[model samples]
Target chain A: MIENLRDAVVDLVYLVCAVVIILGLKRLSSPRTARSGNKLVAAGLLVAVGVTLLDPHIHWRPANIAVMLIGTVVGAAGSIYLARVVPMTAMPQMVALFNGMGGATAALVAVAEFQRFVASGAVTAGERVSVAFGTTVGSVAFTGSVIAFLKLQELMTGRPVRFPLQIPLNVAVVAGIVAMWAWLLGFAGSSASVWIMFGLALLFGILLVLPVGGADMPVVISVLNSMTGLAAAAAGFVLENQILVVAGALVGASGSLLTILMSRAMNRSLANVLFGAYRTRAAG
Target chain B: MNQEFLLGLYVLILTIFLGFEVISRVPTLLHTPLMSGTNAIHGIVLLGGILVAGTAENPLTLLLGFLGCLFGAGNLFGGIVVTDRMLEMFKKKEPAARQA
Candidate 1:
């Protein structure tokens, strides 16, 4: 009876968080309530994390606890410092960098889960698919956001970077990635295949963002932001966590809408923004 | 599919629609803040990191979990702070406050 009660309480808490998050996002639509809305969402997230710590399955390893504490403190403090110091002109870059962090987190979780599967030697097909989906999408979002950050920060040329037969090269990379994915799932089933696929996906992410002009960064960032959300959702599937899926899917929806709006503002189609196929104006 | 997976699918589908319906109503002027705000939401992956790290037994898995937590915290906290700062600019500042 106690066990069942505990489970019911946990499920109820997750459902409440989900509802709060949705209402918070709703409040963000207007400027008047935006700040408070953001805070409300943050509060919801804090409660979710608190409850997760109390989950029965968590191991109480001293080293693991120490690492989490230290990492979180330093990371949070550093991020606040960065946020305070960045100029308003650099806001887009800041968004891209932070979005990259989310993607990196998802990728790390997926990779760690994969390692666990390898260690246990008793993996199911569904688990394999979830892990693969998480890793590939997370890796792409991570590198893609980083490249967008670099472009926006003026560390690299923001012009459409087209070399000889760039389209063909990208096609070849995609084909290679698909083959590796099949190999990992079907025949090889080895750790080496996983790492190789990760590397290729990272490369593909860079290639995907490099060709878009800097002016299209808002669209790029939105797409990457959405990709990160999808990756987080995949992590949810891997972990079988309901709240993660709810939060991730919400972000995915928000980002997709923003991407469409941004593309419309630029008078470009989403495909044009993504594919670099649009005509460029002569330098004024 | 199993019951759990089916339940998860339902949750996912509902949230997606809920997200679209809410966000599409936001004005264009607030898109940047909206992006950053949603960016913070995805930081829920921090929970996943904590779970993985807490359960990890080996050094490699622990390292991955540590990095995940670090990055997730950065995203979670940084995103909110940045968005708040951006929205701060949109606030109506009093001329008297500036004079003081």
Candidate 2:
């Protein structure tokens, strides 16, 4: 009886959280209400996390509880401190840094899930695909955002970094990732293959963002943001979580739309922002 | 292909359209906040981290989960707090202060 009740409560809470998230997004449409909207969304997330702690699936062992407590406290306190202290001039890098952490988290979650699937030795093609997609996309977003942070922070040259045959190199890296994806799903399905794919994806991300000039950081950040959301959604599929699916898709859509809008504001297209890297330098 | 996936698909598709509708109206001035807000939202992956970490059976997965939790928390809190700071800038009104 308690199990059934718990299941029902979980379902109900997830549904409510989804609605609250959507409402929060809606409220963000206007600046006057955006702060409150942010507050509502934060509250909703808090409830979601609290409820997740009660999930029957969680082992709640001392080690597990320790990990959760220590991780959350340190992470939250560090971010809050940085957020409060960072000057307005550094906002772009700040966003990029935080977004990178989110992407890395998504990728790690997918990696953990893949490990579980491998240990069980009963993986399905669909599960493999989701895990592969999440890991690759998340890894790309992670590294890409970090590079963007570096460029924005002026820790590296903000000018577009280009090398001989950069386009071909990137294309080759992408093709390799696709091949690995197929191998993981079709034959090998090993954790080692996943790591290799993860590494390649990271390389691709660096290549993807490295050639863009500093002036175009907004578009680069937007694209990486969308990629992170898509990755989170893929992680959702890997874990079969409805809230992840809904929240991830919502973020993915927002980032994609913002990317388009920002690019349009610059009188450029999405493809141009992403792939037209160094074209101006070459043409000039 | 399964029922769960199909349902997730439906939800995903609907949210995508809803995302477009909701964000289409935000002014350019607030784009940064919007981006950061959504960034914070995706930190929902922290839940995934917690779930995996709570059930991890091996050292690697445990480490991954722990990192996930740490990073996810950073994303969640940092994104929100930063976006709020940005929004607070717009909230300050000069005329009221001048009158005072």
Candidate 3:
């Protein structure tokens, strides 16, 4: 019963963290409370991470420890130093880069799982579906986020880069990726095909985010955040990890809702975000 | 020492330091953007939650993960909306000041 009690404590901690997140979010809605709110949220995350480490099933393998160390150092350094050093004008681009990195990490994790499945020859249909979804979403988020970073940084033009037959080209690439995914599902061990599809989707992500202008960055950021959540959810499915799926779905849904709200704030429609078609008649 | 414990302690100290810095240098001009930028940082919570959830194999883990994502997303959206409103206010003030 001691183990049971431990589990209960962990659950309680998780619940408290969740509540903290809610309160933190509420406080963040106004400038007056933003600082405290940020602290609360960070505390919630800490609690969540702490409880996760208590799970007996979690193995502290060397690779895991190394990865965690690297992430911690890099994240701390970035937030402490780079965040302050960067100018305000570049904030949006920095956000884009971080969001993209999140997506890329999820995709890489999913790919690793797929490789394990292939090597073991124990792949199932459900696993295949999860792999395909994760790969596609992750690839899309990674590439799209990078393009967003470029546009915000002025490395690329903010104007939509529409070439002749642009729509057709995008459609064709999407189709090719989909077809490749289908083939991978059936073949069950075709790494090359999967990688190819990943490449194509990455290209699609870049193309998709490129044409969007600076004015729409807020909406784009929100939408891309949703994509990252969805990708994470896909990874959860692939890994058969409940927390991943649940967390991913929550992020995805909330992100979608936020995207809607942001679009509305700008007096634009969701359709506009999907099509990258909103053009402000009044130029700033 | 456990990695999680070390990380937690580090984050706690960092939080205290950053909090102090923010209070001392709370610029009126930066109020809006700072809030928005930090809100975007809250997006990282989603990343953390997902990573933790991806490690879970049980139903409870899934539920917690889902809830964490929801809360994080809410913060992100709410923060953006507030920032936009503030930006609008700033824009209006600029025009009025120009006229004066």
Return the top candidate by DockQ: 2
DockQ for all models: 0.76, 0.79, 0.05
Q: Considering TM-score, where higher is better, how would the candidates rank from best to worst?
A: 2, 1, 3
**Global local distance difference test of model 3:** 0.58
**Residue A80 accuracy (lDDT) in model 2:** 93
Tens digits of per-residue lDDT for model 2 on A1-284? 88678867976898799889889888877977988898888877777777877777788788888888789889999999999998988988888998898888889999899999888888877788888989999999999999999999999999888888887898899999998898898896588889989899989889989988888898889888888888888888888888888888989998999988888889988888776766766787
**Candidate 2 lDDT (Cα, 0 to 1):** 0.86
For model 2, the docking class works out as: medium
Segments of candidate 2 deviating more than 4 angstroms? A281-284, B93-100
DockQ of 1: 0.76
Report clash pairs, candidate 1.
none
DockQ, model 3, C-alpha based: 0.05
Ranking by DockQ: 2, 1, 3
What fnat does each of the candidate structures reach? Answer: 0.77, 0.77, 0.00
lDDT of 2 at A155: 97
**What range of 10 consecutive residues in model 1 chain A has the weakest lDDT sum?**
A275-284
The candidate that achieves the highest lDDT relative to the unseen native structure: 2
lDDT of 1 by residue, B78-97 (tens): 98899888888877453557
